[model samples]
Target chain A: EAGVVQSPRYKIIEKKQPVAFWCNPISGHNTLYWYRQNLGQGPELLIRYENEEAVDDSQLPKDRFSAERLKGVDSTLKIQPAELGDSAVYLCASNERGRNGELFFGEGSRLTVL
Target chain B: AQSVTQPDIHITVSEGASLELRCNYSYGATPYLFWYVQSPGQGLQLLLKYFSGDTLVQGIKGFEAEFKRSQSSFNLRKPSVHWSDAAEYFCAAFNAGKSTFGDGTTLTVKP
Candidate 1:
């Protein structure tokens, strides 16, 4: 089976520009997660989806960051007028329900804000 | 709040040498533990996991981790290091339907 797939492996944009990242979770997976990983740091959870419902998104910056999972399979994360500090790797992961949290991750979309 | 910590930011080992990467977690109860490896420009891959049974868990790529409840630690170990083992290692803890990851440790294997 194919792993989680993310598009635009690398992206470069200027500050105040809008950027979006897409993720396609593994087939039959019921849970999806979006995480941000700054250089030299571990991945931090941005949002989590159980099917089409976003169960945890408290960590997401509502002012600039928005995410949606359509049909409980594909997810998109958007950052409007992104700041320079937003440069980092956006990682998408997924797992089956009741699987003890074993997550399968994607190659990640690395964004660079100039 | 549940959290994970990896004290060593970087480690260097010679090929064929033994390796150990330390991981510590804080939670109200014993949480599900895991070790993941990330090669440069690649996604994170699961190495091993510790749930409820045995303290020692073996994983892919000749990696193993020992879960110690007394120490609140789950340390990854390899008896023989290989050059391909050079990568970033992350420790994670899952509880209450949430997962937390620690700052990774970069391992450099010398030939």
Candidate 2:
């Protein structure tokens, strides 16, 4: 079985520029999540989607960050005017329909904001 | 609120040596504990999880974790370390609608 897939394994952008990452979840997974992992820290959830509907997005920066899962299979996370602090690994994960199921993760997209 | 704590930031052990990583958690409700491993430039992989029943849970790659409810700890251990096991490990606690993860522990294996 294929695991979650993400694009642009690495990205570099200057401050104030825009950056985006994409993720493709495993087949049949009903829930997808986007998380940011900082240096020496565990991943922090940015958003969660139950199918195509976003169920949680409290940690996302509303001013500059936005995410969408239009087809419920693939997702895109965008950060406009990226800041230096936004430099981190963006990890995409998915789980079964049940909330307590284990999550499967993609390799992730590492972004470097200068 | 739920939270996890990994006391050690980094641990180094020679190959074939036993290894143990400490983790603690805080939550008001019945806790769900998890362990994940991340290799360099890779995503996090589930190791094991404990929701209820047995305190000892076995995971992939010869890993195991013991959940202690009274102490609020879920510690990961391995009988022998391997070079391939060098990576970062995270402890997470889940309850209610939210989950919390520890900072992480980086394991270094010596040949």
Candidate 3:
């Protein structure tokens, strides 16, 4: 079984530019999550999806950050007019339903906003 | 609000020595606990988890963790350290369908 997969392992953009990251979760997984990790810090949950429904997105920056999982298998996280502070690693993880602790993560997409 | 804390920012241990990483969590109810390791340029990998029953849980790569309800702590340990053990370790807690992660601890192994 392959682990979660993410695209654009690294991205560099100037401030005010738009950026997007994509993720493909493990097969048969019912839950997907997007997280952001700053330098020297652990990953913080930005959004979570159970199937096609977003069960949690309280921490997401609604003003500039948006995410969607149309068919529940893949997800996209977009940041429009990204600021310098938006530079960080965006990680995607997935797990089966009722299994909250066993998460499989992807290599993550590193974004640099200058 | 549930939260996880890793008191140590970094730790260095010599190879073949024992190792311990501290973690603490805050939650009203019993939250699911986990430990994950992330190598440089790699994704997070589950080291161990504690849901119920046993307080001590063993995981891959010779890792083990002890969950203490009284202390609200779940600490990771290894009997013998290896150079490959150098990586960033994160402690996480899941509660009420939400998850929280600590600031992570970077471990360095000295040969």
Candidate 4:
């Protein structure tokens, strides 16, 4: 089976510009997650989805970051007027519900804000 | 809140040498532990996990981790390091369907 798929492996944009990242989780997976990984740091949770419902998104920056999972399969993360500090890798992961928390991750979308 | 800590930011080992990467966690309940590896420009891959029985868990790529409840630690070990083992390793704690990751440790294997 194919792993989680993310589009636009690399992106470069200027500050104050809007950028979006897309992800398609593994087939039959019921949970999806979005995480951000800064250089030299581990991945941090941005949002999590159980099917089409976003169950945990408290860590997401509401002012500039927004995410949505449509039909409980594909997800999109958008950053509007992104700041220079937003340059990092956006990782998408998924797992089967109640599977002891083993996650399968994608190659991630690397964003560079200049 | 649950969290994980990796004290070593970087480690160097010669090929064929033994390797150990330390991880410490803080949680209120029985912790679900995991170890993941990330190569340059790649996504994180599960190495091993410790959930219930068996303090020692074996995983892919000749990796193993031992869970010590007394120490609140789950350390990854390899008897002999390989050049391909050079990558970033992350320790994580899982609870309520979410995971908290530690700052990873970068491993460099010298030939």
Top of the candidates by lDDT? 1
Q: What is the lDDT for B107 in model 2?
A: 99
Query: Docking category for candidate 2?
Result: medium
The lDDT values for all models are 0.96, 0.92, 0.95, 0.95
Q: Fraction of reference contacts reproduced per prediction?
A: 0.78, 0.63, 0.83, 0.87
Model 4: per-residue lDDT, tens digit, B20-59?
A: 9999999988679999999999999999999989999999
lDDT of 2 by residue, B1-111 (tens): 567889999999999999999999877765788999999999999999998999999999999999888898999999999999999999987665455789999999999
DockQ (Cα-based) for each candidate: 0.87, 0.72, 0.84, 0.87
How would you encode candidate 1's per-residue C-alpha lDDT over B36-98 as one tens digit per residue?
999999999999999989899999999999999999999999999999999999999999888
TM-score per candidate for chain A alone: 0.98, 0.97, 0.98, 0.98
Whole-model alpha-carbon lDDT for candidate 1: 0.96
lDDT of 2: 0.92
- Candidate 1 C-alpha lDDT tens digits along A1-114: 899999899999999999999999999999999999999999999999999999999999999999999799999999998999999999999999998679999999999999
The candidate with the higher TM-score, 1 or 4, is: 1
Residue A52 error, candidate 2, Å? 0.7
> CA lDDT of B65 in candidate 2?
96
For each candidate, how many residue pairs have backbone atoms clashing (under 3 Å)? 0, 0, 0, 0
CAPRI category for model 4: high
Query: Candidate 2 — number of clashing residue pairs?
Result: 0
Q: Give the lowest summed-lDDT range of ten residues in model 3 chain A.
A: A95-104
